[model samples]
Target: MSALSPSAQRVQAVLDGFGLGHRVVEHEGSTRTSEEAAASVGCDVAQIAKSLIFRGKDSGRPILVIASGVNRVDEKAVGRLIGEKIERADPEFVRASTGYAIGGVPPVGHAVPPLVLIDADLMALPMLWAAAGTPNAVFRLTPEELSRLTGGRIEAVRKG
Candidate 1:
């Protein structure tokens, strides 16, 4: 096994800071998409926690939505819950907010803490996989741990 990339190391540090025993696993190929991540990690796509960043149109704050891989986020519902409409965050904004790029955003360790929301559907899964700060890195965790790590409210973030 080789060393973890700097980005992956940062995520590992955050996990350690939280006293979580999860390990960040680095892959040789892309885990950039939910399908790829599931193939690489050998898990159901629905068990992949895909982190999405949105920009609050009014507040100019970052919003983190960790949705199940198979679910599409209902932006309007999220807007209603947060009291502000949200727009898709660009790569620059995503990097600035999360200290990582679009495909590598993790559930924790953001440069600026966003209003974190975990999809309620994800909580039904016994185990989950999430990005670990690099397109090729990931971590395995429980849904309970995910909620604890991000202090994210569980919501019906999925679209109908």
Candidate 2:
């Protein structure tokens, strides 16, 4: 197995915290986009769970939303749910809050616990894949397991 990046290591630690076992695969090229990640992981685009960070309007807290690769986050609905407008967190804010880069941010393992929302659309897939804290690495898990591990709420945060 190849060595994990610092962020990947942190993600692994979080997985360990939940006693979840996962297989990590590292690829040679960029997996920043859904197409790239799907090709690298040999899976359908819908199976990829894209992790997105947003700033909460109410608490000014960081919110992590795990959405399906094929869907887009419904910012307006999300904002309404949080009682404020939702904006994508900038790279600096993302890194500062999650301790991970934009494309490599995982659903778990942040510097602090973030308000997490798991897109219900992702749960339609039997198995979902997500970044393992690095652009070249990914891990697979069930949506229920991911929700349990991250303590995230199941919501329709994404729109088809």
Top-scoring candidate (TM-score): 1
TM-scores across all candidates? Answer: 0.99, 0.93
Q: Which pairs of residues collide in candidate 1?
A: none
**Residue 92 lDDT in candidate 1:** 97
Q: Name the best candidate (by lDDT).
A: 1
lDDT of 1 by residue, 1-160 (tens): 7889999999999999988798999998999999999999999999999999999998889999999999999999999989999999999999999999989999999999999999999999999999999998999999999999999999999999
Relative to the true structure, candidate 2 reaches a TM of 0.93
Give all candidates' CA lDDT scores: 0.96, 0.84
Model 2 RMSD vs true structure: 1.4
CA displacement after TM-score superposition, residue 73 of candidate 2 (Å): 0.7
> After superposing candidate 2, which stretches have Cα over 4 Å from the reference?
none
RMSD of each: 0.5, 1.4
